[model samples]
Target: MKQLVFGTLPSRSTDQATVTMGDASESSQHELKGQLLELSQLVEPAEVLHAYAEDYISNTQTWSTAKDKKPRLVLRPTTIESLCRVIKYLHDTGLDYKVRSQGFGSASATDVLISLSAFDDFEFYKEEEYVILGAGGNWRGYYDRMEAAALDWSIVPARTPSIGIGGSTLCSGFSWLSSQYGCVSDPANLLDAHVITTDGRAFWAAEVDPDLMWALRGTETGFAIVTHFKFRARPFPENGKLWAGPILIPRTKVAEVAKGIMSMAEKDKQGEMSDRVAMFLYVMRKELLAFIGATQDMLVVHAYDARGEAAGREEFRWALEMEGAVDQTRGDMTMGEVGRLQEHIGELRGTAEAYWAPICLTGEDEISEDIIKKSFGWWTSMLDEPSSIANYGYLLYELFSCKDNLTGRHSSAWPRPVGYKHMLLLGAGCAPNETKEISDAAKRSIMRGPEAILGKTMKEVDIVPNCIEDYHDVERIYGSHFEKLRQVKTRVDPGDRLRGWIKPSRHESG
Candidate 1:
């Protein structure tokens, strides 16, 4: 029998361009082999894979801020059938896979991946007010279309034009519009999804399959691979005013700030004003920045911002007063303008290859003051410690809401019923230079965090809700439906194909 994989550089393709491996004295080579045999559909030839591989390595790669992981294999299938075929091939080979609908940016957390960038299929039916999109299609395209049509809709729109809509909405998806429109999930987001299971069966998910539907929307790519999404969009207020700013509240007042915000949320419920929306709360590095998107102009912010004069002084003053960051004030800006101001924040956390060991315990609660204080202390200490001039930055918080709006729960492949999660995100630049001290400091800061904030009032210092940690819980949570989904995977790609490189549900439970 012939070896499935031949020697490296097995050339095959349409157009030809010869390039030299300039540096090495002699060309290097390795045998090429993969589970291409298990797939039941036509696939890009080995030569195509080799050529694509050559080009992919030569240029860019995809990932979110999630560190230490790069797609072990990046597959760009041209269609639904082709994607399933490739996934089937990978499954039979026992490779773990993660799906990235957008170009992997700073927030991603997987190594082996599938890129839908090549699949640019877009079907827009005018009357439906919705569109079916290939996962890889750029999100900015959709927003621009809506903006052009004068359509005011709010789903999970990416804060960055470059981010992928699928990944953003599916996991911890948040936006400037989150407060007003809720999150990025709802019955509306339940339209339909084209998914490839571990067993490599391509299928659609919706309310029709409630368990699978929920899993697809919330969990990461553990249940199945999502290649297409039917999103929910409706006309909304286009000329909405955006009241956003960074209120430089002293770090010592973090607890007081939390209390004040909680109080405001409670008051808003008790007929404070007519407008409705969830509030934005991000405990950033130096300031606790909060803002909301409103259709109403001349809307009062909170009390008054003592900050000096700015263009939109009235609006800025209102937001500052409400925020109570009063030590000093930064002027308010429109929503679009705010994006520009905050853009630098994204680059502040370490780098692309650094990882933030999540400061979370499975099945724990983070509702105490001590937990908050200690957590902050650990992080602050690490930031102060003598270390590389460049170390991973840490972001800490767990969003608590009643679960409504377009952005529902933090949509991860892993969703626990537990409450008050903390994500100790690590950021770095050079993958190789990210040191152990940096990673350890990040981790140390997290586990001890609860003592800072929760104190004794909190029940447990639990794990973040957005990660696939233990397999048993996954089975328990999904119950019979999970088995059924597994069966579908088994039946479709019987060879046990696409194992790790995007398995059906095998990690912890894949």
Candidate 2:
């Protein structure tokens, strides 16, 4: 690995003393290491180790191999006090640092990485109908706990059980329950949060500052570090069961399935379908589906109805009645069981370099079958590319009834005011040894697939903040809320010490 040079660091003794990375002597590097080690002693149970330490690899693994940037040092802070001290020291000394919860997305620290894995605390107040979740824990553990307790209620969480609660909530998390409860970051679900500011001031955002609280919800950028979340729990349906599973169709029925999905979207818009129903349509190759006993490449409709099998069958009548469709619906399943359906796929994370490009369509826009066919055509063409480095790729369409299910639309920093009813996510993974040029070319092709879907109505598309790329325009992603978020970011973190998925500096010129 190449030696990383992080601009410069000021001396601990005086503000005037500075050491540049390029010119620094061995003594300077030792002095910096000594300072980092002091943090562990300052707070009990905290530990600081060099990046090459044996435990470092296990502590800092992420879902995407592309995010594996090794830092100079790793800091594991066990308590809130330790985290505050670490943050304050980094801010005061003008050091570059990054925070990691689950290391799922693009989280990397060039100088120091603060690992929050020790903050795994969970508490549920049944009488009050709310739950407190630690930032370090993932949704899988939470769901397991809920099942162990045999509780009659549960909170809304991301679809993938491996996703971290803190990172997902901060990025406006979407779930199977979203059609009924909206995103996990919405005010109705995410009541309050325990956060630490850039200067190490710890407080509950909702109690102390409305501006901070608003910014924390869906900004997906550097505002504050949230340690825990307080979410309101919803009553589980009677028997704690719902209808959900995959309905497989051969690739030859691509046009028919696409038309069926569009028809369902129209019914949702007309307020004719139940809000409890949601569907995901995806294209997968035969090789990927072999584990499920499938003999051919397939287009799958993963359907859900919070109401039982009877209602689900009624809601998805068109798809079920279609010719050559295989119904693999689990008669009725608990939320935990529903989540486990995708666990096999989630296990593929970190196996290769991955990329995502997403496009969202609002309720006002009309989606024609022609547009869907063109998008599918683009995806299929890439699978046939002889020299393509994208060994595994899939195109997914997420459909939901948004208008009637969501509440408090203006409460969060999410830019889409009217809310989006349809989302198309294009994902691809390549070998880790692939060249940057080849990987970038594959990403560009994936990005163009969405454009083919939008056709001449491209301007009407909305952006899903969690699925955005570095090349995407900030103005379009944030929409009209860009300036307000910038002001809030500038006020809270004037120096921009913290890093987020979308940096505020990207919009400075606009």
Output the number of the TM-score-best candidate.
Answer: 2
lDDT (Cα, tens digit) per residue for candidate 1, span 1-510? 111111132222333222222232232211111222222124454322332466453212433233424433344555566666556556544444455564333323232345666654555555666666666665566565555554444344545455555655555354444434434444444366766676556566663454566655543444566676766655443444434444444455656655554454445446462232322233343222343322221111222111223423443333455443442323343333433433453333334433333333222333334444555555555556455423444544422232343333333233333322223332222244447665455445444444454452122333322333321144543334455546544444344333321234343343
Q: Give the Å error, residue 313, model 1.
A: 8.7
Which lDDT values do the candidates have, in the order given? 0.43, 0.72
**Local distance difference test, candidate 2:** 0.72
Backbone clashes for every candidate come to 83, 0
Per-candidate RMSD, Å: 9.5, 6.7
Least well predicted 10-residue stretch by lDDT in candidate 1: 1-10
| Candidate 2 structure quality by residue, lDDT tens digits, 203-302 | 8888898888888877665899888888888788654578999998888888888778778767866879787888888877788778778788888889
Q: TM-score per candidate, in order?
A: 0.64, 0.88
lDDT of 1 at 230: 68
